[model samples]
Target: MIKTENVSMRFGGLTAVSDLNIQISKNEIVGLIGPNGAGKTTAFNTITGVYKPTEGKVIFKGEDVTGAKPHKITERGIARTFQNIRLWKDMDVLENVLVACHLRMNVGVFAATLHLPGYRAKEKKSREFAMSLLDSVGLADLAHEPATSLPYGKQRRLEIVRALATEPSLLLLDEPAAGMNPQESLELMEFIGKIRDQYDLTILLIEHHMQVVMGVCSRMYVLDYGVTIAHGTPDEIRRNPKVIEAYLGVD
Candidate 1:
């Protein structure tokens, strides 16, 4: 559902990503993996409209979305979460997710301020929907907890729930397993798999954890110095010479 063609991005003299091309199909949990500075996140940023590519095009759902505004891209059914947790620091868990609900709700500012019947009804609907999204990600019990007060793993899971609240057709997850213990990461892998199937969503994930990628992703792409090196199943990725060289040092 997402495709990039000959994409490149540079920051000053450094090319963070170069000539990268990738295709992620609907309902596919595709993995984007690389060593540090290999430009996996850069590619994700470019595709998700966080950073427009310096060269080439990004297409989603068959239309050119190159350089589109982030919200417009989101409105077109793409949602993302960051490597670092980006929740509303002072808000409750449900409130953070309600922020995503703003996209689909038709309540106007004046109506909300006046507490008009339409606005009240819309907000009630949004609240119910957001709560359901939180429940789906296993955060129902923490709905009233302050977002900043959650543990690291729970905070990460909260971010996922917030992303899913956007009602996306394709979800881009940036290092979802980053900073979690083995058990926590395993639970996240299971949750991700269940939600992907249950929600019928496509996922493009950037994960440093081997187990998370192997456990959840159907296909994998390996990047080395911002170039595509391998694209195959997890087992094929494990045996590829270039992938080994990219992960392990080569003399």
Candidate 2:
């Protein structure tokens, strides 16, 4: 559903990503894996419009969206979670998700300011939809709890749920298993697959945990120092000399 052609990002004298190319088919889960400083997040930033690529094109569903604003890209059916959890500290779980649901609400500013009937109606619908999303993800009971009160794993899940509130077709997840134990990572792998099937989503995942990525992604691309070193199925990647050398230093 998304393709990047020769995409590169340069910061003054530094090139963070170079000639990166990747294509994800509909409803497919793909992995972007590399050691720290391999430019994996840089590639995601370019694709999500956080940073405009210095060269090449980012095509989503066949349309070029290389330099579009982040919100514009979100409006075009893409949503993303960051490497760090970014839930609003003061908001409850449901409220955090509600903030994202507002992206799709059609009420005018004047109507919202006045709390008109139409605005109220839309707000009701957004709440119902958001609640359903929480229910689906098993977070409904904790809806009114402060977002920061959730455990780290649930916080990660909440961030994904908030992104889902935007109703995206393509979801970019950055290190969803960052701080989890092995068992928690295993559960996260299951959760990722469950959400993909439940939401009919195409996912691009960046994960440092090899088990999670290998367990969930059918295909992956490995990068090193701003260059794509290999792209293939997990088995192929595991056996690839270039990938091995990138992740495990060679003497």
Which candidate comes out best when scored by TM-score?
A: 2
Tens-digit lDDT string for candidate 1 (50-113): 8999999999999999989899999999999998788899899999999999998867889989
Stretches of candidate 2 off by over 4 Å are none
TM-score of each: 0.97, 0.98
List clashing residue pairs in candidate 2: none
Error of 1 at 210 (Å): 2.1
Alpha-carbon error at 171 in model 1, in Å? Answer: 0.6
Report lDDT per candidate.
0.89, 0.95
- Which segments of model 1 are wrong by more than 4 Å? none
lDDT over C-alpha atoms for residue 215 of model 2: 86
User: What lDDT tens digits, residue by residue, belong to model 2 across residues 3-119?
Assistant: 999999999999999999999999999999999999999999999999999999999999999999999999999999989899999999999999999899977889999999999
- Provide the global lDDT of candidate 2 against the true structure: 0.95
